[model samples]
Target: MSESTGGTGEGTRAVRAGLPEPVKNEPTLPGPVFAAHFHLPGDVEGPYTYGRDENPTWTLLERAVSELEAPGRDDVQTL
Candidate 1:
């Protein structure tokens, strides 16, 4: 077990990290999005153009790691 911080245990924090706020009909934890390619009309104007480059699953994992490592600091960047 790891140390606790901000009155929350490491295990607890890890479990709750990166979780978005509750929605009326949305699941508490969203399922992973698996895709090799996304629709691109003309040019790649959006963040997610390729699966290997970027995806919702990676974004969520990054958020979770960032939260666990830096808590309330939004300036923290996770790779």
Candidate 2:
């Protein structure tokens, strides 16, 4: 067990750092409002075939959290 945030070096990083800012998706401090889906051009297929598949906000949060957990997050599983 680490005297700091867990013995894992990755865990230490997670504890010290925060999330990454949204790059292309960035909004004002207000941030991008939630959109269930983006309209695709005719026959464009899709950026997201379905809303259930993925969302921008979800991705932002996931990326941020992923970094915090870093090496520790090798194989995250949700039961």
Candidate 3:
């Protein structure tokens, strides 16, 4: 239960859970990214190189799930 959703109804909490803060020119929920490979310059030292290995979509999902499961705890990690 996030601080925002604390003491709120389950439906409300579920709907509000894991939502990112509002940005000026961004959607409330980002669209999915579907790329098998990313462009890497020089050595492969960037965050994403292989889709199967890591993805921004999954990262956001994990964060959301973690927040739902363990709110206010940065030590929690979801997969």
Candidate 4:
């Protein structure tokens, strides 16, 4: 356990910490999302524009890595 990883060991933090909470009948890890563009009816500006740029899956991974690097802290930006 390490302070940087919220008291979880490096392996556990690398594998599970900051990941989306598991639900019954759902996989522990989310699968990759495949799409070029989503239906944008109203606003043209948003976090997701194209798959090449960013998506929800990537967002989760980013947050997980950030937490592993600096657990229990919000001031640091990992992305």
Candidate 5:
């Protein structure tokens, strides 16, 4: 595909995308965030206010899977 869309190869993009940037003395991959409930201390105006609704970890995984399924494309919907 194009370099702008997902850089070089499928294997490279699949493993690199949807992951946190490398940091000094930090794990390459981050741990999962699990929570059945969250403290709504203020106005609920963020992407994550409930666990059941969505999870950051899951979102990243979904993106990675989508890229693997269809590279250089945006018409992807996961159930």
Candidate 6:
């Protein structure tokens, strides 16, 4: 959400959004990406129900991508 989002280009957004964070209730810093499946109880409810729904895998992938690409101007040691 920005006042100038209307005219911003893809590259602008890519550089402006900064970077994403890792999500999980575990001690893992960066995890693996898996198309997981889930099962729920009839007397219970769950946020995710399918592999494509949402899982730790997607979160791990997102964080990995962000971290791998999150290099500041000075981070470029050479080239």
lDDT string, candidate 3, 1-79, tens digits: 3345446665665666676866998887777776677564675676666567677877777777887788678689777
Give the TM-score (vs. native) of candidate 4.
0.62
On TM-score, who's better, 2 or 6? 2
Residue 46 of model 6, lDDT score: 52
Worst lDDT window (10 residues) for model 3?
1-10
Candidate number with the higher lDDT (2 or 4): 4
Considering only N, C-alpha and C atoms within 3 Å, which residue pairs clash in candidate 6?
none
Judging by lDDT against the true structure, name the best candidate: 1
The digit string of per-residue lDDT tens for model 5 on 1-79 reads 4354535665577677666568999988877676556565575576675566677877887777776677656678663
Which 10-residue window in model 4 sums to the lowest lDDT? 1-10
* Clash total of candidate 4: 0
Model 6 stretches with alpha carbons more than 4 Å out: 1-38, 47-49, 71-79
Error of 1 at 22 (Å): 2.6
| lDDT, candidate 4, 23-59, per-residue tens | 9999987777765766657877866866666788767
Worst 10-residue stretch by lDDT in candidate 6?
Answer: 70-79
TM-score of each: 0.68, 0.38, 0.63, 0.62, 0.56, 0.33
Residues 1-79, candidate 2: write the lDDT tens digits.
3443445465555543334433685752335645554564675564544466576556545655665555445354221
Candidates sorted on lDDT, descending: 1, 4, 3, 5, 2, 6
Order candidates by TM-score, high to low.
1, 3, 4, 5, 2, 6
Top candidate, metric TM-score:
1
What are the lDDT scores of the predictions, listed in order? 0.78, 0.51, 0.70, 0.71, 0.68, 0.46
What's the CA error at residue 39 for candidate 3, in Å?
Answer: 4.2
lDDT of 6 by residue, 1-79 (tens): 4433347665654554433443576543343443446454673465544477456655444544453365333232221
Using TM-score as the yardstick, the better of models 1 and 4 is 1
**Candidate 4 runs further than 4 Å off:** 1-7, 37-47
RMSD of 1: 3.2
Model 2, residue pairs in steric clash: 2-7
* Candidate 3 Cα deviation (angstroms), residue 43: 8.6
